[model samples]
Each structure stands twice: as C-alpha cells, then as structure tokens.
Target chain A: MKQSVYDLTQQHRSIRQFKDEPLSKETVQKLVEAGQMASTSSYVQAYSIIGVTDPDIKQALKEVSGQQHVVDNGYLFVYVIDYYRHSLINNETKGNMETSFESAEGLLVGTIDVALAAQNVALTAEDMGLGIVYLGSLRNDVERVGEILGLPEHVFPLFGMAVGVPSDDEQGSPKQRLPFEHVFHENQYNSDKTQQLEQIKQYDKEIQDYYQKRTNGKRSESWSEQIRKMMSKKTRPDILENLNVKGFMKK
Target chain B: MKQSVYDLTQQHRSIRQFKDEPLSKETVQKLVEAGQMASTSSYVQAYSIIGVTDPDIKQALKEVSGQQHVVDNGYLFVYVIDYYRHSLINNETKGNMETSFESAEGLLVGTIDVALAAQNVALTAEDMGLGIVYLGSLRNDVERVGEILGLPEHVFPLFGMAVGVPSDDEQGSPKQRLPFEHVFHENQYNSDKTQQLEQIKQYDKEIQDYYQKRTNGKRSESWSEQIRKMMSKKTRPDILENLNVKGFMKK
Candidate 1:
C-alpha cells in the first residue's frame, strides 16, 4: 500500500523560486504555532525563530546569501540554535543555569532541536501548499545574520528557511539519494557495502543525462565531475573559530 | 479557522513507557522511508540512521543513556550526523573534498540534515499512533556509543528517538512553554525582551505545580530551579576533543 506517510515523503523537493506574493500574518502564525508544537528537548525549548518581512532587510539578506531566490521571494525564517533563554532564566534564578560548551554534545543538542522544529514548520507550510527552501548559505555570514536578528551570546543562527507559493516553472525533481542500503545499516555499520556501486554508476549516468536533458545536452558531466568542481572550490564559511568565540568548543 | 496542522502539532509528546511489543518490520520500514523523504542540504543527504533491535545491545544503550525505558521501550533509533558518505564519494571521484577541522559547516549541515530527517520520523510515528522521546543524554559517552554502532569518522551520534505506543500512565501533560512573545520575534530580534519575564515566571510556577501535583510536592521546584540543578551537575560526555580527532575544527 502507498502509505500516506510515504506519500508525504515523496512530495518533498527544494523550491528555489516563488511567485511575487507576500505571506499572510495568519499563515505565519500557523506555521510558527505548528513549529512550537514540535517535540522540544526537556521543555527547555532552546531555539528561537525570527521572521523577516521588511523588503530592505530581505534585500540585504539576499546579498549576504549570494542572491538566493528564497531570501527575497517569500517568507524567510532564521532559525537560531539558542541557549540564551536558558542563560537568561539562569540569571533570574541566580547561579542555577549555565551554558558550558565542554563537548560537541552540547552543540549537537541545540542544533538538532532547531532542526526538528524547522522541519516541522517546513512540513506544515508544505501541507498548506507552499513551497520552501532551506538557506544553508545563511551560514556564509552567520555573524551578520546574528546581528540582523539581534541575537545574543549562546544563540547562533543554524540556518534559514524560505517559504512561498511556487511559480509555475519552479518545479524540481527529487535529488537522487544513495540507496537506502548505502545509508542504512542493520546491526553494525558495513563500510565495505559497495554492492550498489554499479547501481550508483547508473545513477551517475542518469544524473548526467538529466542535466543534459535540462540543458539540451549542452552540459554533460557525471556526478563525480560536478562534485569534484564543487569540492575543489572551497565555499564553506570560517565558522570554526566563530563557534569557539560564540561559546562552543571543538572538543 | 482551526487548522489540521494544529491537531498534528498537539499530537506530539515524549512517550517513555511502552508495551513490550516489538515494532513490526513493516513499521520500521515505513518510519525510515518517511525520514529519507526529509529535505536535505544541497541534496547531499548527509546523514544515516541505525536501528537497534538486539535486546542485549538495547540494554547496554539503556544503561549508557541512564534511562530504564530505553531497553524496555519500542523502536530506538540513533540518528547519526554523517559526512562519511561524502568522504566515500570523494574517494571514488578522487575529488579534493576537504576533511579538516575547518569543515564546521559540514558538521553543522550533517547535524541539521539528520535532525530534520529524525523529526520527520517522529511526526510520522505519531501519525501512526506511536509516541517518541528524544534522548539527548546518549551523548554522555560518545566513545561507547561509537563503539556500539561501529561508527566511522565524520559520523557523529546526534540524538536518540525512542518510539512506540504509549502506555496509559506514560501520558504526560504538555510541558509548560515560555510565552509566544518570549520565543518568537518579528523583523528584528529584541534581545532585552525581559517584558516576557512575568510570563516566564508564570510558566515556572506552572511547571513546579505540575511536578508537585504529580509527585505530591515531593520534588517541588520551579522550572528555573530544575534547570539550575541540571546545569549544576558536570555529567556531560568526554567526547568534545574527539570531534577534532574525527576531523572537526573548533577554530
């Protein structure tokens, strides 16, 4: 049976373009309320979301994010991995609460908490027939984003999500995934699991063919070639020292 | 108008006690399939999930997590923040993908990507009438968990989600939340938004009352007080430096 959950799963795709329209206040409220309804950790609810609506601010964010369509197209949400609220609460209660970055574990909890909440909001928006894109580029200059959001110490912007009704030609196919066998392991992780190599090669061919078809066979390169080009040109942010400065240890 | 998303949101809660019944193979398949359907970064899909079924192993994890219900519960899933697939793909293509501590962006992407997927599984599980509790405590001993799962470098254990049908007594009330004003911000963040301090204080009182009513005031304390006690203890894992060893740089 084609289950409803699987149906929802099949419906997900990253949307980069949107119709020129603004999101309603009611829609924003519903999205955030549904997000708050997400499963939070220890009821600490250690995450904060900022909704950006001012076109001037959106234009600035678009520049910061390399002119991504989502930044300027519709509703942009900056999800912050926040422990600042707990710190505030701690201050109120005296020397009770603390934000210690002794290990990667602390950072992991905050990141995951924000991720879960954001996904819930994304799904709820999609259920409302809106398209969405997650702005990983927000990290390109997270400090800028933090400043824009007026974030305090212990609250780092994990990333942003942009949501809106899709323009007609904005549909994109599901990006091919490594087979479930490659990603999922049974009892112990099997690194030697290359039984799908040949299948993946076929997938590489399929990807190249799809790109060619998209460009009328003008650009024909395998997935490996594309990855090589992308990897060779390092575009990652200088966030290592930034996290340390913001209070997370590499430990 | 009441939104269906509201109903779905209200359905989320942490379920600790579960019947000894095992989840069918079909159930696990459906859950993981839903997870795989989550939106990923650049379609890199940088995450993997491992399902634990062996009772002995489950018991061991339960001990590690310091939660009795871990072994006695339904399906326990360890959502892993993984960049190993990209590394392998890099190897195959001889793509010069950097695997340095400076890959803070990759780690964040992996952690956030997997977390988004895990949250989907939680929601899908709930839709199937199941309950879930995210166990952040699993990070208390990263080395042990890594050993148990045979995790490779670049694949860090993010969090655990214990999923199953809830036993009647296990139903906990919605944990009191900070007011909407405290958590949500408009175009820009208001850092000194202590205007909501009164609301937070009210929540603290509500949580203390909840604990007292449930425990006959045996462990009466405000939310802030409980958080203080939790932060007072230095019981986190010793795997912070290990991230650097695993190729993550704190800067």
Candidate 2:
C-alpha cells in the first residue's frame, strides 16, 4: 500500500522532457475516467476535457505550450473550465437570468472542478509510470488555443497536460517550495514574519545551489532574482478578456 | 504495487461522513507537503492553507459549508488563493506592481495556480486512506469565513477540504457524468449533437438510479430538474466585491 496519500502526492513534479512512447487509447480512456471520478461542484461537473492525438494538431499545440514534451511525446489534454452547459440549461428555463454574484461563484466552481479533475489525471498518469508536465504557458495564447481546439463560448482552457514516458534526457528533481510555517497556518492564518523570511532566504539558497548542480555550475540565480525577473515582466494570452468574452464578468 | 494509476484512481470518491477518528499532526504535515509539491505558477506559489482543528472554528466553518459533515468531522482545511505575499514583496521592493489583471493573463495564472494547489491537497488527503469533501458552499459567506480566518487582502478563501477517517453515516456512490463523448473532444472539438441528447437521457436515468440507491428511494430528480434548481436561480456573494475593496481588479 502507498501508506498515505502523501507518498503519491510527495512524488508530484512537472516533467518538461519526455520519451517518445505514445499512450494507448485504452490508457487514455482510463485517464479520462479518472478525471470524471474527481469531485465536481454540486455534481454539476462544470468542465470538459479535450484530448489531442493528431500529430499536426499536437504540433500546433506544442508551439503554444512552448514545445513541452507531453504535447509531442504521448498524451496531451486540454482542460476547459466551462459554464456553457449551465448557460444552455439556464437559457431554456430562465430566459437569460444572470447569475449575479452567485454566478461568479459558479465560475470559481468551474475552475476548481477543472483543477480537481486535472490533478486526478496527472496523479493517475504518474501511477501508470508516466511522466507529466502541466502547460500553464497554454494561457499565453488562449484565443489561438481556443480556435485551434474549436472551444466555444463559455468554455475556457484553464491549462494543458503533456504526459508520457520519461526519457533519458529528462532529469526529475523536486522543486523547492516556501516553508511549511509560511504556507500552512493553524486554525487561523498566521504570517510568521521572522520564520517566513528566514525560511525563504534559506530556500532561495537551496534553489540557487540546486540550479548550479543541475547545470554543472553554469547557471545560477537566487529565488529572489528569479521572482524579480519573472514579476517585472509581462506575458500574453489576455485571460480576463477571454473570460469576459466567454461570459464571465470580472466585475 | 498498484497495477495502474487508473485502478487506484477508480477508488476516488468524496467521502463526507467520517468515523470520528482524529489525524495526527505528523500526518497533517505530510499531507501539506503533498500539496506543496504541486506545481506553482512561475514558481510564485500564490496560495496558503489553514488547517482547522479547533472545534469552535470548525463549527463556524460547518455552518458556512451548509452544515456539511466533513466541515465538523475531523480536519478542515481552508485553501486561501492568495496574492498578499506577492503584494507584500511588491511593496517591499517598491515595485508598485499588483497581482490583478494588468492583463487577463495575470488573473488566470493566479487563480489557476490557487486551484491547482488546492486540488493537490484534496488528492493527497484521499491517498492517505482518509475521506475528504470539498466545501464549495464556503462561498455562501466568504467575508464571514475571511473574518473567521483573519484573512488579509489578496488572501481569499477559495474552497475548503474536510478530511479524516470516514464514518458510515452515508456511503457515497459514484454519480453519473455526461458520457465521455459528450465531454471529451478529439483533435478538433466535436459537438456531437445526435449523441448528446441520448447520452443525457441515459445519464438522467443513471443519476436517478444512483440517488435511489444512495438515498434508499427517498428523493430523485432528473438532470434537467437539478439544473433548473441550481442553474436557473439567482445567487450572490458580496464578499467577492470586497476583492476590489482589497485592491484586486479581477477585471
């Protein structure tokens, strides 16, 4: 037995590189079932998944995902947080009744439902001895991705997953995270000032050291440096506008 | 050893009723680590979790969660989708940057990051041989929940997880989902018009059957009836407006 879910969970990490082996249709069906088994909002199941296997389509997605392996290596799935189904039903019954602030709650539920389903897919892939990487970068160009996938209004791609066998070129290393004291509060939310700073500083050093080791002492940057670089920049795939276009009011 | 991740995944079902058994601190720590191991956006890790063990606090949360059993059962975790830490760093650096929608992309990444981390927490909890339920009803009163959690700006509670040894109050049955063809698309998104109605009809029967088995024939409703009840209604969560008051323009 795995003893604890932690054992399976502690094993989670993003795999960017992958082996060329392909996932069978049977395995893919299993993956989809795992996702469906995940908890849904009020059992509404407010999400849908699109699996891409065609080489040409996968290549197009690979470009969108910044050439991530799962798109090219084995199985690629785009998880869409959707309200379209509800909207269809609402139109039939209420004649365009807006959901007000509670409707915003529906958006969150959809997002959460997609997240839960995606997690199950990722973990189940791991359990099947497959390497997987989530392509958050897919949000970099949602319109193109939506067009490519033929996603209709009220359906937005939350993220993509590339899953396959791990290749020799792939080296899986656990990423450093901010400490427990910082991330996990007690009954109440606590910001342990000193502990947080000290732990972060230590974690920064560890990340820098890890990078140097991985790169044979070629590249190195502190966690703060990385954050500064990443935050001080901007990216594309205007998500808010897309959500609005998809019928969500950020208002 | 597990034969396939799919085999293990099929065992997943949200368990709300618990056995009144408590979890150890070490176990909780391990579960949190599993969550931490989940991928973060640009490695920002823009989320925090609060483990509620105090009976009083859990009781208040139980009410927020529509009196869900898991909320008061054993361990309750409020996953806060946060940007406060980023805001703090921005202020410290005099960066004058906001985690809000400078572009639509920012909002998507932040919210998606939060969702992904929370999903990891739920899965890990289940893997631990413990039962867990996601409390989407927490949105019923986000501000009150925030007040209870003492959440600062940019640290909003997204959803909650209640985990522990499951009790026999009610055994959960796998609810029927729209058939895979209805949800999963191939290379191009296919709206299978002909198959949709038949599949839904089958699903309505499946859901009705599931309710009959789970509730001992007490109550039943078709898919459309449930949708009419849930989707064709008006709901609002004022706490969401507070996001703007706190300086997050989700727009």
Candidate 3:
C-alpha cells in the first residue's frame, strides 16, 4: 500500500541539491493542474504560476535569489499573486473591482490563494518522487524579479519553487517542529505567559540537542537563538513600498 | 493502489454540509502533525491552530463568519498568524526582532507559513475521507473573531476551516478554473492585453456553462460578473487597521 499523505507530509524536507534530470512536460502540466484545483477564496483564483525554462531567465532569477538551486533544479516555478486578469475584466466592464483587489484584505486573500496552490504543487511533486525547496530569496529584489518575469501591475511575485530529483549528496530529514501543545490551542488561546515561556524553554533545549547531534557537537543553537539572529535586523524593508508599486495593499 | 496526491487534488471541491460525526482525537492529532511538517520560512513556525469544540465559542465564531458550518462541522479550526512566541523570546533576550515581525515582509512570511500548513491539513483530512471548506469569511469581522478566540497581541486570525464527513445530500463538483494557459505562463508572463482579455472571455463562458449545468439553468453567471458583484465594494475595509492593532505591519 502507498503511504498516506499524512506520512508523506511527515517526511518533507527542503531539497536544495538535485540531480540534473529535468521533469517531463507532462509532469509540469500535472503539477500545475493539481495547483489549480486548490480552493480559491470566492472562486477568485488570484494567482499565476510562471514556469521558467529559458536559462537566461533562470540566471536572472538566480541573481535575485542568490541561490544556485534556482538555476540548477529540473523545473523552476515562480508563484505570483495575480489580479491582472481581474483588472482586465474590470476595464472591459468599467467596473469598480479595484476597491477590493487594492485593499489590504485583497492582499491577504491573494497571498493565501497563492500559498495554498503552491503547497498543493509541492505535495504533488513530492508524491511523484521529486524534491523541492521554496525560494523566498526571490524577494531579495522584488522589483528585479518582476522585471525579469515581465509581471504587470496587480501581480506580485510572492515566491519560487525549485523541483527535481534529489542528488545523492542531498541528505536531509524533517526538522523538529514546535510541540503540538505549544502550537495548538483548545477553544481559546492560552495567553498565560509563564506556560508559554516554559514551553519555549523546553523547545529550545530540544532544538539545541538536535543541532548538536546533527553536527556532532560542532554547532548547538536554540530555536530562539536562531530566530533572534535572523530577525534582529529587518529583512526586505522595502516590501511595503514594493506592494504599493505593484498596485496591492493600497487601501 | 492508493490515489496519488495529484489525483486527489483534481477531485477537490469545497464541501459545506457534512455528516454529524466528529473526528477522533487521533485523527485530529495526525492532521495537526501533518500541518506542522510543512516547510516554514527560516524555521519560523509563525502560526497557531485553534480547535473550537466548545459550543458557545463555536456559536460566537459562527456569528462572526455568518456560516452555519462553523457550528455544524465535526471540527472547526481557526488558523492564526502567530508571532507571540517570538515576541516572548525577544522580551527575554531584549532582542530587536520586532524590526522584522513588524515589517510588511514579516506579514508576508507569516501569512505564507499559515496557509501552507493549513493546506496540508486540508489535503490530509481529504485523504482520510473527510470534507473541508475554507472559511475566509472569518475575516468579515477580524476584531470580533480575536475577541471570541481570546487571541492576543502578535496573533491575528487569518481564516478558519470546517471539517467533517460529507453528508449524503452534499454534492459539490470541482468548478472549472481559468484555462491553464491563462494562469500558467511559459518563461515569462504574457501581458499582451488582447490575449489576456480573450482568455478571460473564454473562461467567462466556461464558468457560465458550469453554473448553468450545476444549477439546472436556474443560475448562470460569468466569472467576471460574479467577481464584479462580489468585489465592487470592499469586503473588509478595516483589515489593515486590524492587522496593525494585532501588532503587524507597523513599519
């Protein structure tokens, strides 16, 4: 019997190094079909998928992402929050749909739509024996990515995915997640600071142990420590301005 | 042989009515575990899931959503973008993590994390022979939802999901999506105005036919018409303000 999706999800790890074998056209089409079937908020499929096959375009994107895998993967897909189609409809009908698609709620709806579709693509590709990694680094230069992809207004490049067969050197296991009790609330949120702090402390110890073992004691960092190091300085401070330039979150 | 995730996704349809059986604790735990395994941005598991079982709380949320399924489903999950734990870490370390979590980029990252995890749960439940519908209606009253769920600062309710076994009367078929060529661009986005408008015109007809066939010719609305009607006015004008109130996008 095939393993369940739950089991499949449990085995997920970001695959950065991949074999050179490119996915077949059929596989790419199947993955896109799977993505399209995901639930859209009010049937407003406010997203698009860009399949980059041209090496020059891949090179351009790689520069923006600063990741070799962006160019080395069997297939690269950049998912964008797209309202340009809706804008077309609005123009033809002389409608006022901008009141919704330009609002902050519009941003939330579009972002959720894109992520749901991308996850479907990710899981489906994994089931097909493909490894994948998300490229949020594409946001390193949102304007440059948009220019590279020829994205129009009301279409924002949210992230990219590099998918292919994992290489022999690509050995990775699922990272530990926050304990179920820490992330799951029953009925209402438990905002008790002491309880939360205790949970974090316990989680911190577990993460530190995991890192020490993984690196044979060469590295040991708590989750909080890693988070502090990463988040202490703002990353992509220009995101709000970029969203405005892309005709999103204007309201 | 078990169905592949690709095949499973093609069969997706938002299920509203459901049988009266609640999911077992084991199943819920399994689903949550699957959700947790989804890839997070830089290990920032910036989300929390609230399982609503109390009848009063369910009713309160139902009022905010204005959806009967909120109270009638076997399970109700409210997915929140959570940075509270990180804030706790920041407080203890006196770190400057707020510079990241309060920025627009942080909003994007947290929203992506929550949706990816939620989609995993949705697919896992469907694989287990359950029905699920996303409740973006939860955003209809964000403040009211926070009050009902007792959510704190650095935590914002993005959406909800209602899950259960499908009722005998429930018969939802997968709706037609935009043409693959329209949503999936090759190499780069095809921003040619004539081509895009033509594609939308074709999709509008297909959607019209779908609704006519599904509703026995009683209702036939084009995709653009429905979008215009639903989006001509803003849905949630206060979303930006609410996000700010919850300590997001302050930058």
Candidate 4:
C-alpha cells in the first residue's frame, strides 16, 4: 500500500480501533527513521520518542489517556518535549546549565519539534499501510504519565500516538473539516467572522450529519454546538502546571 | 521537481538565501490549500497564517525578525497560534468568550496545529520547486511581531516561513544532525547520556566538518560545543512575558 505521502496524508483517519497484528521491529524502525529526518529547531532536537512496548505500561498509559486504543495498538509512543539531554551537553561544555531550553521559547520550539516529528511519523505510517490515533487525552493525567515513564525535569510529555493495522471497528470516512476559506486567508488575517459565518453554518449541518452517521444518531450535534459544550468551561487546567513542574518555564 | 513527499522531506534544507523572484498569487493559494488539509487538534483549527505581502509590512517584519529572506522572498507567512477566530464563534454561539482558547492546553495544541499546517506548506512548496526557511528568529521580538501584525488578544505569531526559488548563496551540503540512535531511542528513552556520549562525540566531529565546510572554516565547532555556547546564555527571555500578556495561560 505504498502511496504518495500527500495522498496518504489526504486519506488519513484516526484509527481508534486497531487490529491485533503487531508491526515488525523493522517497520517501526522505518517510521522512526522518517521521524529522525524531520527538521528540528536549530538542531536542538529538543524532542524524544519513548516507545512503550511494555503491555503493563501501555495499559497504564491507556488509563491516563482515556483511550483504550493505546493498549490495543501494535505500537505506542509518548512524544515528549525534551531539554534534558541538551542540558547535559550544556553542562559538559559551558560548565553551567540553563539557557534557551528553560524559557517559554523552549516550550514553544520543543512542542513544535515534537509535532513536526509526530506528523512525519503519522504520514509515514499511513504510507506504510498502518493506522495511527494521536492521544491528546494523555494530558488528562499528565503527572502520572510522567511518573510512569520516569521522565525527568526539562522533559514534558506532550502527546501520544498509537499505531497498528486497521480494524473493522474504525469504519466510515474521513472526518469533515472547516472549508479552506474559513481556516485560511490571503495576505492579512480577515479576522472579521462575517465573511465565514454562513459557510460555517453550512459546515455545522455537514458535521451534524457526520456525527449522526458516525454514532448512529446517538450524538448528532453541530460543530458550534460541540464547541459550545467544550469551551463553555475550562479545558485541561493541569497541563501548564505540569509543564511548570517539569521546568519548561522560568519565572 | 515533483518527488515523493518523504523524499522531499528527507532532502529538506532550510534555504536562508532565495532567488529574487516573487511567487504568483495562484501558486501561493495552492500552497495554502495544501496547508488547510493538515490535521488539527479536535477540529479546533486553532491557527491562522498571516501573510505579509505588503512591502512595508514585510519590511517591518523583516526588520523585527532580523531575517532578510522574509522581505526578499517571493512569499512570506507568519504562522500564528490562533484562537481568536474560535473565540468569535464561541461568542456567537455560547454568548461568552473564555474557553479552551485561553488555557495552557490551548497554547500547546494550537502550537501543534500551526506547525502541522506549516510543514504541509513547506512540503507543498518544495513540490512546486520552491525553497523555504523557517524564521524562529521572529521570536526575538514576539511582542513586536504581534503588534506589527495587529494580532488580537488570543492570537500570537509563533514562527515565520520565507519561501521563494533557491539562490546560489547556499551552495553547501545539508546540515548534520545527531545520528539515528541518538534521536530515535526504542521502547524507552535511553536517557543514560553516559551510553551515548561517545556516539555524540563522534557526531560532533561530523558537525564540526559540516560547519567548517559551510562557513569556509571561519567557524568549526562541535555539536556539543555549539550547544554549550548556545545554552550557556538565555535566549528569548521575553517570550513568556509576551505570552502572558497575550493571554495564553491561566494562573
């Protein structure tokens, strides 16, 4: 099922249900190889992939992630924003640690690095005829996830990805996204929502239909309704606290 | 010029200097089209590309970013971590503003959204035979960049990408990064730097060679040496202050 990366990218669907089949070591290596080739921030390479092959750990990660696919998948990896390794090098050479790696810039750049590498992994996994589901829910219990992985300071877990062969459980088509014009704009940001309002109303209907079909009418809500429900209250409040405890920011 | 996205990704080298030709409007539109198809976090679509096409705005951005390619390049876009649009939609739907848009998780996820979309643009631009250089230096004056772009409270300029045809200025080989083992540890983070020190030392030699050849020996420094020099001093100290002022985090 080798295909153009763009084609695979276009065809991407998060596989929450994965087959029992396990990927070979060689295949996983290929994915990591693609990940390693991703561009890093100034070659700081401030991201690390902690592959969790241990079943007990996977089960625990699944518990915290609120996603059962994490344990059932052929492979799982916790992507972390890492500055620990670089700090060691800083210690060795400069004799004193702490630099850009301890600032807000570090968190921003490191998160970008992790995402870039994970997108590479996702795209390459799709190319290799595999399925992936990114687990942002891992942040539901960020502190325990860190304890489980023994992640040290200056290393914050950002997200998780579970990859494996597809199962029949994950049926249906790719999810609908906002139309191009709404999300993207020319030259300057036309922050005026007036232009995109009607289009989004239409998209809400499409999403409502998608949710209807996806959940067998168990949940059929418009996109905005969903947003209203989600954003009506605070989302994960502990994330920044976790990051701060991990030393991602300096006062 | 058209190649597999993976091939192009592996061959990606940020072009600091670009030819003095401007990209056509249609070409850039296609790039953005590709960008819009990138994966978003929970369909929040929390990012916006602020294109700076006006020569004056581009000049100001270039001055603040300290990257000439931004002004010289055929196309320039400052990828912003945006929740302002969502806030508008929330305002319309939920009648009030604050939601995930102003949380720590929001910042993390929005940053991922921007990078994923930007990487798609980079790859598509490469497919179109153009070169791109990401301008993290834009963070050097994050607040100023935000003010220059007229960014709203919930929108922040994360990074910039300058795209155009390749110039003869960057004639050297690609930059050297840490080898596969150093980057892609398997099943666990081999955080034991003691195990990887010798390998990184070997990699330092390779980086030294790369910098020497690229800079014509005006600078020949090892990877650790460079990391030490860079890490020895703080960079972008204003980033957190700017993010705080921009309202990205809640207590």
DockQ of each: 0.51, 0.57, 0.92, 0.49
> Over the stretch A2-63, how does candidate 1's per-residue lDDT look in tens digits?
23444666678888889988899888877887788787766667788888888777777777
Model 1 has a clash total of 4
Candidate 4 residue spans exceeding 4 A from truth? A1-5, A94-99, A196-199, A212-219, B1-4, B93-99, B213-218
Q: Which prediction has the highest lDDT against the true structure? A: 3
Using DockQ as the measure, the top candidate is 3
lDDT for each residue of candidate 1 in B24-118, tens digit (9 for 90 to 100): 98898878878988988766677788888888877877778999877877788888877665666676767657643127777787788888888
State each candidate's clash count: 4, 11, 0, 0
Clashing pairs in 3: none
**Residue A34 of model 2: what lDDT?**
89
- i-RMSD of model 3 (Å, 1 decimal): 0.6
Candidates 1 and 2, the one with greater TM-score: 2
User: Over all chains combined, what TM-score does candidate 1 have?
Assistant: 0.91
Q: In candidate 4, which residue pairs clash?
A: none
The residue-by-residue lDDT of candidate 3 on B1-251, one tens digit each, is 88999989999999999899998999889999999999899999999999999999999999998999999998999999999999999999898899999899999999999999999999999999999999999999999999999999999999999999999999778888898888999999999999998888888899888888889999999998999899999899999999999999998
Candidates ranked by DockQ, best first? 3, 2, 1, 4
- Native contacts matched by each model: 0.53, 0.60, 0.91, 0.45
Give candidate 2's error at residue A248 in angstroms.
1.9
- Docking quality tier of candidate 3? high
Residue B65 Cα positional deviation in candidate 1, in Å, after optimal superposition: 1.2
Instruction: Score each candidate by Cα lDDT.
Output: 0.74, 0.73, 0.95, 0.78
